[model samples]
Target: MSDDLQKELGVVRDEIDAIDAQLLELLNRRARCAQQVGEIKARHGEAGFIYRPEREAQVLRRIQGLNPGPLSNENVTWLFREVMSTCLSLEQPLSVAFLGPLGSFTGSAATKHFGHAARLLPQSSIDDVFREVEAGHAHYAVVPVENSTEGAVGRSMDLLFSTPLKICGEVVLRIHQNLMTREPSLDRVTKVYSHAQSLAQCHEWLNRNLPNVPRISVGSNSQAAELAMQEAGAAAIAGEAAAERFNVPILVANIEDEPNNTTRFVVLGRFDAGISGRDKTSLIMSAPNRTGSLHNLLLPLAEAGVSMTRLESRPARHTLWEYVFFVDIDGHRDEPKVAKALAELQQQAAYLKVLGSYPAAVY
Candidate 1:
């Protein structure tokens, strides 16, 4: 390197150091403000709910809107999310549970939404994940509800139908299923492993790359990573987190058949969130078992001028042929239009339960 170049870089380094110091000072000031807010809430005898889903979403969206960036909006949002998370922890660290063996995509979503400061408890099953929060052992739960490529997560949807936990927030994770193994190349891989959903997501890639390799479906992605770590001539289909956590080498990157493969996760909590301007309401309802009853059940949403975003159906338990409908609609449940639609919906439906309304995923 030339002396002139070194001198120029050294000047920039000094400026960066000064900026670092200022950031440290400002971060502490913000943290102190968070603590004061907590104290004030304590004085008022309010229920101490430190994690405000709507408030956090509003802040992230506002930050993204105001970004004048060399850094992309996503990078800026992530940085600010960490800062807010750190500040919130100064008030009270949260406990979040997810289905896992650590390094599962659900675990990543939990951290993405809660930040690393929150204590994350990994459970064996989706039922256990819900139980952890419902029993007050954990503050919240993050569970996958659906995927873009393969559709609904059946177990999660089934649990949501009965669980008392409310949907307080959501996360949308862009899935990048990598081929990871101890071997340097895919040629030596005799077998493949991954969760059923992940295996389905990468089906086309596997057919072209390893036509004869036996693809095994395991309980979770992390478990597949674990098997690959110990088994010879084996590879796992998982994400960066699993590869890193298990120290497996990634032989192929983003092997998902769909380029835009994504998974949607919902945060389960006991209480509901206040309205965020752009919000979504999720609910489960069943129509009367007569012809045209399902259409009648959904007519109120259109009549009230509320947009319906998603509609899914699952077989209702205890009834051989009956099914329940899961619906997502624009606007918070608190909004007048949404409230009116829901009121009308309640009158026409045989059964109805508003899972909860919350801020939509910021991304």
Candidate 2:
């Protein structure tokens, strides 16, 4: 730590700063070119010029295919995701909404998908998220659809059944549950609080460590952290963001039983991802009650060479033996083959609702 050495180090840091500035300038220049491409498309009267998943995928894959540097596959994917997100924003700023109060996982996922620069709004409930997008208050809304540890988020499914909003995009987020507390000692911990799913994910840890302590379920993990701040004897199971927001110390990090725990969030918006040659269409249909009725309903898709991605049953709400099948299949609604398949499917279904067709998340 001599003065000469410090001066030399400072000079190196200045060079690093200069290199960073140049890199940023190059990025902006590239983004401007993307904006020009968008402008050209706009001048040609192309409808909805911003998003192009196929082209983006091709670009990223080409970059990865040609990459020779130290940057790994994931590094390149992340970098391009940000770069494309920024470029798209230049064409048109994306307005996104998510379940609110800031530090929630849905909020984090929304930010992750659209980037921090996108105009993000927070809604109080899942239905409100749909309403926001439907009412044109926001371009899209990110809502938790399902979790690996806890199955489906029922509220989102229910909203899907009721709302006209289409599923435009999807995001998968890794869930890490942290036990945060204000108490300095585990011995002083009297109670644990967290969201219902977080508690379930960390049930083994809670039972093993604080067997005698009572566990309470709060509205959200962030709320649990806030509760723990007021109650010194309590700890909260939540994400890292919650811990930082509440200024609670993380007692046990990554307490979820499964390390590969991830949640799938769906983006609902006024428009679908459009006819990207590769995509998935989600629909709700009810078949007549018969042994072969379900089989017959799916037969048309099979005949058309369509692949079903997901099929989940939910109660139809009105009658005693009635149910709605939420079907997701690999095809776009606008495609001729898919359109024909759906037309045939209608003959078999008592009720059919084409929820949406959107580009499947490539990851």
Candidate 3:
């Protein structure tokens, strides 16, 4: 209420307003440059190829590195993401598909990776998401691959084996599940619903709190939230976004067993991403069913000085009891050492498929 304090606050506000004007001018200038870039690409007959994951990754990384700020690096990168998304949309709007009824974590990952400027199409199933992109109905698709707590999404892994689309990018979303319902109190709740992965993620918490409630696994957390909206005695476990989307109230928050629960999602597109300095490659390989076949498959990567980040096995769908391995390595396939290793592994393995070499998640 002091005059001096009021004057100081007014002055600061005026300065902020002035800086915002400058930022607006600069943003428009940047958008105009983006438009020019699109026109140049079209002139070279490269129309409909506006997005470049490697390039965007480089830009975001550089921005984060150079950031001198009161705002955190994640916040800075997110602002730039929206800016780029908007500029890209001005050039040509992109259509992205995700497994959803809307408000699913996969949908959130798609938005996080692609931004709100892109049109989002929610599919009924993961297979539908892949089919949408494969049929050219969508430029890209986002699908959940794995979770830190509950492990790999079996359906997504199975679909990846058959889908011709490559992984162009990846998003890692930290999940915070909440118990939500339309009802006012948990005392009235009789049934709990959520995606199987989510239910598993919150298994311990559910057992501790809603011990007597029957837990039902649904296709998506969004679908579960929808059901909660309809049924009086039903509660759904999902993210905060789903609560807002469905106009449901949160009964409890952070109910997952692990506080650091996260889900990894992959963006699928027709072409693989080019090398970004910090990149990761995903591949599927099957070794001949023989002793030492598995060990021999990994030797080349170690010999080539490539570090393996993750390895998982899934049943080869066509042949019963046969297993295929999915591996994530810490380098692009085009790198000299990586190429050498992959070539050696290809010859040694019964089958090999390079899923993609994409920029690693920035954060």
Model 3 quality (TM-score) = 0.87
Instruction: Write down the RMSD of all candidates, one decimal each.
Output: 2.8, 3.6, 3.0
Q: In candidate 1, how many Å is residue 55 off?
A: 0.7
| lDDT, candidates in the order shown | 0.89, 0.81, 0.89
lDDT of 1 by residue, 266-326 (tens): 9999987899899999999998688888888899999999988899888899644398999
lDDT of 3: 0.89
Worst 10 residues of 2 by lDDT: 146-155
lDDT of 3 by residue, 191-259 (tens): 999989889889999888889999998877778889999999999998888888888899999998888
Each candidate structure's TM-score, on Cα atoms with residue i matched to residue i, is: 0.89, 0.82, 0.87
Give the 10-residue window scoring lowest on summed lDDT in candidate 3.
146-155
TM-score of 1: 0.89
TM match of model 2 to true structure: 0.82
Total backbone collisions for each predicted model: 0, 0, 0
Candidate 2 wrongly placed segments (more than 4 Å):
1-29, 57-69, 147-152, 275-278, 289-296, 299-307, 318-321, 334-341
Q: Using TM-score as the measure, name the better of candidate 2 and candidate 3.
A: 3
Q: Pick the candidate with the highest TM-score.
A: 1
